[model samples]
Target chain A: MKQMRRRRVRRALEEQCFLWLMRLSLLGAVGVLGMIVGVICWRGAGALSWEMVSSLPEGGFYLGREGGILNALVGSLYLACGATVLALCLAVPVVFYLHTYASPGGRLRHGVRLALDILWGIPSIVYGAFGFAWMVYLGVRASLLAGILTLALVVLPILARTLDEVVEMTPVLLRESTLALGATRLEWMGVLLRQSLPGLLTAILLAFGRGIGDAASVLFTAGYTDNLPDSLLRPVASLPLAVFFLLGTPFPEVQARAYAAALILTIIVLGVSVSAHLSLARLGRYVIR
Target chain B: MGGVVEQPDKGSQRSESFRLSGRRRWSDRVAHRLLGLIAGALCLLVVGVAAALLLRSLPLLSTFSLFELWGGQVWQPMRGLFGYAPFVVGSLWVTAVAMAVAVVPAVFSGIYLAEYVSERGRALLKPLLDLLVGIPSVVYGVWGVLFVVPLVRDWIGPWAEQTVGDALPFLGRTSPSGYGLLSAGLVLGIMVFPLIVAVTEEVMRSVPREMREALLSLGATRWETTKCSVRRVGLPGILAAVVLGFSRAFGETLAVMMTVGNVAQFPSTIFDPVYPLPALIANNYGEMMSVPLYEAALMHAALLLLGVVIIFNVGARLVIERLVRRIR
Candidate 1:
């Protein structure tokens, strides 16, 4: 009886220890995130300046010269927006095809999704290399156009998969009713579009956020320049690249500028993420199971 | 005679409707096939990327024998020494360190969130994990430089040099400057923590409630139930998560680049500087065009990186899928 009681006490102690360990792990994950964001904000705030956002860089910017990342900020927006638009155009049709045309849980649907998953898993740097190689073959230089095309390829899978998930959640009864009313396949697509509009919007925003934040993918393909890109053929600056470049320099001022660029990039991503989360929460009701 | 007449009239009307809709049905079929073709073409894009990488890297393959290119330790592109041993080893070491540091906490957190936490707590934790995922690598890189590197240099490095360093011969040769394999690995570990936790949580959640209930009824404690039944069922999935996280760490560029001092060497100690393939490419791609075989070498490196990552990801997916099938 005494031995049984001792065993029970030990088991209780072990359970408590296990629970605390698990909780500690949770705390660790949250702590790391909080620490990273906290440190970036603390350091980046000191570097943020009105002139930095308002004006372009002057001469000798890399050597701690007076300059702002206006060129990079504008370039990043152009690249991200362009990529998101182009990706949406391609992704919507593919997603629609998967849902409307393919049989439920068919081989073709599985194969296509598996392919997309593979593509999605391919690292961004690989996309950059592929883009660079393709550009060389096509006799095109690294420009805004090249960056957008490359980024589109990167974000296409993401947008398609997210939109596909939302579409798949759409009730089969809805589809049956629409078809029962003698709706054409094209018209059915319109119905799916209407139903998944909120989710689709969220997907686009998420893709844009991803495109804007990725640095390695565009590192070589974007071909950064000091001046703002006026034409699609010219090279462009981007926030990720700007942060990467400035951080490399030894100068304190330029390093601070890198932090500021990071802050802007983080803000954009955070905004998109929050908006996506909000939309998901609100529009979730419209989705029937 | 009346039934026969009605059947003939019905057949005639059906034929007329079929004829009337022929052109419309043809267009519909065409549209369906067209969209299917587009979707298939999207799948083919990955194959195209592989081909492109192979074609681009052929120049390097021609210059150096396959064995020589992969087997050589040095990677001086300017001097035409395009061996990839150091970079590959560097990548492996860093990823190993990251996995070692991250896997335990990630698995624990996954268990906590999936089995132990309240629904409200799970909701709060999940969004925070998403936030972690959304934070850019560049931000992590900057943070690493500001905090992690210094912490390692001043405290962790010295402590390790005194304790683990004395015990382990390789660790005895430590760098006073902390930015090296260990720092890069730790930062990568932190970056990958959320992904690991997320995957683990999913795998743990998929363990049916009945299994937990049965274990508890059999006089198993919550910990024992989780460790024996839940973890046993989810082992393959946990491994898949680790593989995925490892791939993420292996391919990570900017954060590793910033934290890893770009010395082209096989790190003898965790403190010693090392350079991975991604960093090598990112740092040198600009100057590569100027040099002769440099561009080819970088292409080769990219191809190698892609092959490794794709293999890992595809293999992990297969394992996870099998695990899901078994669970169902």
Candidate 2:
């Protein structure tokens, strides 16, 4: 009993030290990351001005008077909104068709699932290549129309997969409740869609966050130019594309501007994703209205 | 025959159609067909794109002989040579060294938070990792150049030169500018550390409490029980998390493009200029216009990257599959 008591005391002493070390370590990590964001905010946020917000990405400190990111910001908004609309345009009826209409054991259903899984593995780079070929080479739509279409392709699998899950999560009784009442396919789809609208919107917000961060696809297909976009055909900078251009330069002033731009882009994405997460989370208590 | 199967139902529903109008049997059938066709067609796009990428690269399929890509050291684009040896080897070395620097501290810290830390500390520290996740890769590139690069120039470069001047040549060419594997790995490590910590912490928390309690009841130290008992149970998840983080870091582009000295040669030492595969793809994909084969080479490089990411994802899935079994 004396020996056992002595061992217990030693273990307690060691455990206390270990816990302290662990806490200190976590603090150190958090501190390092906090410093990174702090440094960006400290230096980058200073450059934001009323005029700067309206300028194009000219090559000077804050890209000179013309160094503003207004065009790219607008371009991103246009492309993102268009892509989201196109994807939903494509996904809604597809879900209704797949789960509601297709025989569960059919080969076509099996093929569709296999196709999405394969696409998920293909790198974003390859998609850029295809966009270059299909949009610019073959198609007449070579401007923002092409960019939106490419993003639509990139985000399609993710949206479809998420929606499939959401559709599945809807209690079957909700569907059967309408179906047993002799409602046609159209009525059931309308009702079920309204019920799952929040989840679908959440997927869209997530896609927006991803779309803004990606630079590669839009790089070649949405080839950059200096003028304010004359129709969708003219290439303009997006925030990430601006960040890429700024960093790839040799100038110190340009580098600082790039830092500012990157900070803006990251915060914007973080804000959207966080809010979307909360919004989607509200679905847990949703009453369908 | 398929139409006939629905015909009887349609005939029975005609009585109800008297209550409705205009929407006929043929139109409903056409609508069903159109919806199925569109959904099926939409799903085909992913496979189609992947297939298209693979097929277009078939002309140079002869060039991708794995041995040529992996075994040779040369990467001269002008000569139409595509030996991936340099870039491939560089990727492995950088990723491996970076993982060594990242994983050790990340694991211990992750365990600390998951098993040992007070709630207040955990709450404060977790957001930093989230912030790290949120920081743009381009911003990391800027900080690396402005702060990390110069710090290496002043401190690490000279200190290494003095310590190992006669003993090693690595200290000789070490970019006194800090734009080498060391800085690259440092930035990569910082970027990926959050990933491992996040994953390991999650897995540790999910481990049954009984395992930790049994060790504690036996008078094991808290760290001892958590480390040996809990970590053992969650080993596969830890492996998966590390690989996932490393895969992401390996594929990173803009940050590596800005910070990696952007040189095309195989790395000579911890300090030599280098390029990663994704950086190669991003930098040259648009600019290699004077040369046609060069564009093809970039595409081939992209294919190479896609191959690696697929392997990483597949490996992670296998580990996760094992985890699922154990949980069940």
Candidate 3:
């Protein structure tokens, strides 16, 4: 009886020790990551103000008083918006036709997915390389048009994949109804496509979020110019570019500016994603698969 | 049986629908053929670039001997003798060190959001991590240059040298180049943290809850059970995540370029100047100069790096798929 009681007591002790160790291991890691995020935000938040957001990053974010991110912010908007529009225009018909009209035995669908997977798998630097070779090499220069064109390809796979599902989810009955009405192919496409526009727009927005925040694709093709972008051929400074440019400078104030810019970029991305989720919710009934 | 077989009325109608929808009209067939060809062409485009990287690198092969590129220690390229030893070693070492620093904290953040947190917390954080991944490397490069470089040199440098002494080669040296192995690794660790956390959380969520119950029922506390059940189950997924992170960190260019001191020699110490594979390419690719061979050498480096990354990526995908099946 005495020996058995002793054994049970030892087991209890072992269990308690293991539990304590695991708790410490998991929480300790959490503490360290939290510290990193906290330090960055605390240091960065103090450097931002309304004036910094409203003007150009002319000299740098020296005091959060002199230069602003207005130029970069506007440029990112234009480039991302243009790319998103172009990608959506190309993707919508391709996606719809693949789902609604194409035969199952066709290798076209398989090829489309394979192409997207490859595009997604390859590094963004390679895209920059291709853009440099094709556009910059041909003396097209590092301009906004080249930047948009590069980003469009970079984001096309992601946008196209998501939009394919959005189109696929549209009721077969809707297509059938149009077919029975003797409507021409284009007319049917117009009506059904219009009805699914909101969901399609959501996918485009997500791609825009990705495109706007991307720095690698723009580095070679877009180049850097501080002035407001005037023509499609002109180089532009984007928000991420501002952050990138600020890092290498000598000033402590400039580093602070990079952080503040990071904060803004984070907000814009969150807004885009939230809008996408809201749109996903708006797409009711067809939400099954 | 004869009546069923002879039912031609509805069968013909059904066959007609299938045949007409199946076989395309001339214009329809032309359009189908055209679109499929276009889509196929795009696939060819991506493959074409990857192939070009290989083809562009062919000239590099004639310049550097295989043995010299792999096992040789010296990297004196100025005299036209190219050795890839320092770069390959540095890339792998930095990647391993970075993953060690990265995995633990990333797991905590992921677990905090996935398991410990309430619905509100998950809603807020999932998007933040997504944003973190979206942020550009140039910005990260900037952060590394201004903040990470100084922190390493000023604080980490002195402490490491004093504590570890000459035993730690990289820490012992003092160089003008702020580019060091440890700092670059830390910056890279932060950069790829989100990918690991995101994928690990996904895999963990799929793990059944019964294993947790079985452990807890046998007197294991929630925390203890998690370590054994959830953690053990999550190990292979985390390992795959680490490989993916390593490949990215190893192959990365601009961020590592700006931060890592761009010296060509093999680093004797962490504080000594180090060159990574991607940095070598980025710095040289733009400045291919009158020496056409220099560009060829850089292309050679890109090809080797590409081969390594693709192998690791394909392996990780397979591992993750197997892990998923086993869990299911």
TM-score of 2: 0.80
C-alpha lDDT of candidate 3 relative to the true structure: 0.70
lDDT of residue B179 for candidate 3? 70
Off by over 4 Å in 1: B1-27
Q: lDDT tens string, model 2, B1-328?
A: 4545465554675576444344644555676889888977866675576566566556556666767766767877777777776777667666776797788778778887788667987766675576566565667776777667777778877878788855887665457667877778777888788878987887777777887788879867767888685557778888887887777777776666677776767776777778777777777765575864666666666677767776786687567656756764
DockQ, structure candidate 3 = 0.23
lDDT of 3 by residue, A74-179 (tens): 8899889888888776676577667645665487776666566546555566666566656623677788998898888778877888787677677778878887
- B122-240: candidate 3 lDDT, tens digit per residue: 77666666555655566566567657788887887777778885775646847644577777877788877887777777777767888767887997655566567555887887778
lDDT, candidate 3, at B105: 68
Please provide, for model 2 over A1-289, each residue's C-alpha lDDT reduced to its tens digit, 9 standing for 90 to 100: 9998898888787888777766666666777776777777777877655655676656644444346777767777777777778877887778767667776769777666556544554545556777765653365544777777777776676677667777778887887888787666666777878888888887787777767666767766676655566676666556777777866676766666777777777678778767666777676467342
Cα misplacement distance, residue A272 of candidate 3 (Å): 3.5
Q: Taking the tens digit of each residue's C-alpha lDDT, what string does model 1 give over A1-289? A: 9999999999999999989988998898888888887888888989898988877989988787777989999999999999999999889989999889888789888888888878887878888888988887898888999999999988898889889988888888999999887667867888998999989988988888888888888887889988888999999999988898899899998899888888888888889888887888887777655
> Candidate 2 — which residues are off by over 4 angstroms?
A1-6, A13-29, A57-67, A89-123, A133-142, A157-192, A278-289, B1-46, B63-66, B105-131, B159-173, B201-225, B228-232
Docking class of 3: acceptable
Residue B188 of model 2, lDDT score:
80
* Interface C-alpha RMSD after superposing true interface residues, each candidate, one decimal: 1.5, 4.6, 5.1
